[model samples]
Target: MNRISGLPRMLAVAIIGALSITALAQSNPYDKFRNREYSNKGYLSEADELKLAEQVHQELLKQFRLVEDRSLNNYINSLGQRIARRSQRPNLPWRFYVVDDKSINAFATLGGRVYVHTGLLAATRSEAQLASVLGHEIGHIVGRHGLENVKRSQKYGTLAGIATVAGAILGGQTGAGIGELAGNMIAGGYLMKHSRDAEREADFLGLYNLRDAGYNTGGMVEMFEILQRVSQSSPNALGSILASHPPASERAANTRREISEHLRGSDQRGERDSSEFERVKPSAPASSKPPRKVRPRN
Candidate 1:
């Protein structure tokens, strides 16, 4: 009889242990690394991600000057913040910068840092288009692309080099040296392209993100169309985005399907453009500026 009683206690212990393990697995907010889940922070801790983002942000400022206009910054921030608020990592203190380059591209780094080119701003016909781009970038962060890159790159090795440099930066490395290294990795031509799976996930996340932020999902479709148009009309003007991801046509097709399947019946209304976007867009032109008028040519 005593032996039979012990067997029940043993069974109880085993069941409790299994349940505890399941609970722990479920409790972790981040997904398992290999699962390709959106909102994954990947292998990097949040602190490390922030440090890398700071370094990258510093490098971006050094390589491409940011627009000095406060109004322009505020306008981008307002929209970016709206999209980010609906993101999985809504509480991450996000930062948005307008790169002075008119190159028709935008990218997101670690933490919540995102950069938009002046060319892209000029190209977008509506605020919704801008939100689409920004939402895609936010998806990258919420998906943790930069950290994923570090994990996958044989050359980076958890970025041992960056760790050393980052330590030095915390101590004595000048901004220029760090900027050169990071700029080469980013702007100078060494960007790590995200996988097709990651790209598709970003598009999905971005699509929903805009809709949740009350922006029209159609904006994402239009943005993809703009990318396709740019790729066909001026391939060289395609910039880093196309170089890093799949073709715009594929992306556009996917967005159309998503709208059909998920968002077709929804009545979520979002702003297509704001007075601020209209007022500040002139300051962020694509390509080149028109020549100034000469008063005394006659």
Candidate 2:
């Protein structure tokens, strides 16, 4: 009778242990994506993700010259925030900045930080196009792509390289050298090169954000078309964006498919242009300075 009671206790212990292991796996969040295509949650807590993004933001500030025009920055911020309000993580401290760089690039870090280069702004023709770009970047933040990459790197034991660099920046070790390395990784898309699936997910989410925010979803397709034209005519101007993203044509096709299937009436009813965007448009031309080549990394 004692042996039988002991077996029951052992079985209970094994069940508890299995449940504990399952709970731990669930905590990482990405484990659920094995059968699914996308997820918004990453391995890091909200506070820790914000902290990491703050570190990256500081590093980025050191590397890029921000557009000092209050109006331009404000307009971009307002537009980004508008779209961000429709995202999965609506309450994040969403912030947008215009980089003076002439490369047609826009990227989002882990937190709500999104940076748009002047060249990207200039490349777009209408408010919807520009909003589409902002929406896409916001989608990346909503998806927590950067943090997901961080979690993935940690799992593969490769996160230490950048984590150490971030620590050195916070700890003020080696000063500019360490900070610059992190900034370069960011610029080169090494630290934030989200997978193609993540790109598709961002596009999917961005379309909804655009439509929900009362902007035309067709602008997403137009954005891709603009990128395609830029790639063919002035490849150097779009090198960084093209390098890190899926082919513009492919993205355009996918966007078209998504629109046809789920958003058939969206473009017909949404705002496609704005007088304010035209006012801000002239200031968005590429800077005279050559763009810093952002080497793409997978």
Candidate 3:
């Protein structure tokens, strides 16, 4: 009789142990990410993303001087709109900004907002190169890389929760919390460097956009060449330039290989440069001073 009773008790213990193990597994987010179980549909809703974007944008306005020239704004908008329209999230209200910062860097945020540093604009030799940069940034949005990063960080429940708690402590609107999350997320998480897989995906998407939009894909290669040269000396000084994008050499070689294998027999030579681009290039000053635009749209 004691043996049978002991058997029941042993079974209960086993079940409880199994339950505890299951709970532990479920709580660890990295396991899900490694197993490809993370949600791709996005962790946040469209409304929430838009709110976060607005909050971030407002913060940016106070931090960086924006280029408000009309011609330059229109030129960038025309280029950005064309590339963005070909993307998966074409319906999103895409807004591009020319940041007056002279750093050779550019980044995109939620809700289809992209910021191109004046230095980056000046660095490009042609419109096609500029498109390549814009295309890559757009790829991040359409590929939902920022969202993936946010979700990955959310795996750390404590840190993610702190964002919400901080917002509540501030006692502002719902958007305020999201804005805080965005600022922190970009500063330390999302908008920083991306995984190799994410970088490859964005590169391919960018090349596709550039090619399909009637631009020579060689421009992508040339742009990388310029970047590689820009950093060949004192690369450390320009670490921010490759903060999110991969090394220029690796990217250039990848583009060449992809073009040879997939885009074979296509026109390797399309419009390489444009007079209009030359007119607009100087608008991106090497200094932080706001460049003249025809009008301010963004």
lDDT of 3 by residue, 93-191 (tens): 999988876678887777789988887888888888999989888887777776666556666662465346234434546545555565665556454
Error of 3 at 63 (Å): 2.4
Tell me each candidate's RMSD, in Å, in order.
Answer: 14.0, 14.6, 14.5
TM-score of each model, paired residue for residue: 0.75, 0.77, 0.76
Model 1 scores worst on lDDT over the 10 consecutive residues at 289-298
User: Cα lDDT of all candidates, in order?
Assistant: 0.73, 0.76, 0.72
Order the candidate numbers by lDDT, best to worst: 2, 1, 3
Q: Considering TM-score, where higher is better, how would the candidates rank from best to worst?
A: 2, 3, 1
- Candidate 3 stretches greater than 4 Å from native: 1-42, 161-175, 236-241, 265-267, 286-298
TM-score of 2: 0.77
Number of clashes in every candidate structure? Answer: 1, 0, 6
Q: Write candidate 1's Cα lDDT for 199-262 as tens digits.
A: 7777777887889998877788888889888888987776776556778888887777667655
Candidate 2 per-residue lDDT over residues 188-254, each given as its tens digit? 5665688887887777778888999999888889999989888888888884654578889988987
Q: Which ten residues in a row have the lowest lDDT in candidate 2?
A: 27-36
